[model samples]
Target: MILPEQFDQNELFVLTSLLIFYSLLFWLPNRFPLSLIILMMISSATVARLTDHLLSGSKMNLYSIMDLDKYELFDFFTYLLYAPFGYFLVYGYDKFKLQGISVLLYILVWALGATAFGEISLLFGVFKYKEWEASYSFTYYFIMISLMLLVYRFFKRSYKLHKVEIYNR
Candidate 1:
């Protein structure tokens, strides 16, 4: 997309964070199948967009992304920002093999971390709020990450079943 006319915190945050996360995405070992990575990114970005619509849309109007109160080019890139994070979230979940109550604790830790990072984004001008608080995003992150973990498990089971079927065939 187009860069902002001026180099500011908003641009710096999105671009720099995107670069960092994408680097981590690639640098990290392949802990998941390619399909799962694709799924995580798609669902992560979609959930981000949809929730932004609900909270930031004309009706609720909780916050603004980037510079303006309106959606801008960087706003789209900001969604790109969420994709790699989703992969890492589930990647760590699987790597730990968290079970039972541990799953709940894992989601809680991720939600807290996401909320803290989001506050960093606020400091960097990635988000400006009118009626929203960083605390609220903790709930959003918790629910979304929990859903992603469920999706990962479902996909893992399906992949195993499909592989076994093909091998038997």
Candidate 2:
């Protein structure tokens, strides 16, 4: 997809910030289901589109294929787009049953896998980017993954400390 020539730094910042924020939300509360996160992502995207329309006074073009009407295909792909990765994250965490440092490594592996898949999708034109370089994809993913690891470690440590206090009681 061809991006607009005029760059809006504020909008770009908001989009990137939201993506990272949501990524961290998904990473936390390890027991939280992926479906919930996917739902939140969809809702957020819809709200973003609506906000764009209100700001631009025009409806956002969803997607198109060739000259024929093919919005459904686009919508379907978008809906299912993150399911596999989300599933993999949850499943991998459970299957490996990691704890402590192992959890951090598991999250890193999942993040790398997700980033590779995202790059592949972008390369094949399955999705498009705006105001983002190809290399930025890796960078963004790395940041989110590192943030997830940090947050997870913080919570895990807190829980352990709480458990110790309870045991002392």
Candidate 3:
């Protein structure tokens, strides 16, 4: 894991980002069940991978993650960065109980923040644009985040129903 020869700014960026993000997440009080937490973590990483695959594929060639155009070991670690992001996104949605017009404002704020984070990654050499602009991702982030919230509600409701059924039985 300590390959100083191959280690570069991109790798360092991922490591540092992971440390910071996970630390912040761990510091927060538990707001959801452990199973839901696990689900959100895995699903976020999965969504990142799937999105990256589609956008960065040869057909689109929108951008390159980390060093070369191919997916490197560092790229895998980069996806882990999304787990905490997804958690925070939905966490706030749940924690704040955002409703009505406030929900729209919340989504706008987060989409902007994510776009800004993407720009920071650009500065850190974590992403190289071929024909892509960071602005393009704002809409993508907005839609994805909205979907995540919906999924969270569905899962939360389902979990409650499941638990009630088990207890009643």
Question: Which candidate number has the best lDDT?
Answer: 3
Q: For candidate 3, lDDT tens digit of each residue in 1-169? A: 3233377787888899999999999999888877788888888899999999999988898998887666667888889999999889888888888899999999899999999999999998989998999778898899988888888888878988888321110
For model 2, how does the per-residue alpha-carbon lDDT over 1-169 read when each residue is reduced to its tens digit?
3332333442343344346545765665444334433443454345433432342232433332112233333333333334333433543454456788987777666657766765664554444444445455556555655554454345445657766321110
State model 2's lDDT: 0.45
Instruction: Put down candidate 1 lDDT per residue, 103-142, tens digits, no spaces.
Output: 9999999899999989999999888898998778998898
Ranking by TM-score: 3, 1, 2
Clashing pairs in 1: none
Clashes of each: 0, 0, 0
In model 2, state the lDDT of residue 169: 9
The full ranking of all candidates by lDDT, starting with the best, is: 3, 1, 2
Cand. 3 TM to true fold: 0.91
Best by TM-score: 3
Residue 10, candidate 2: how far off, in angstroms? 30
Off by over 4 Å in 2: 1-72, 139-169
- In candidate 1, which residue ranges exceed 4 Å CA deviation? 1-5, 164-169
RMSD of each: 3.4, 12.2, 3.7
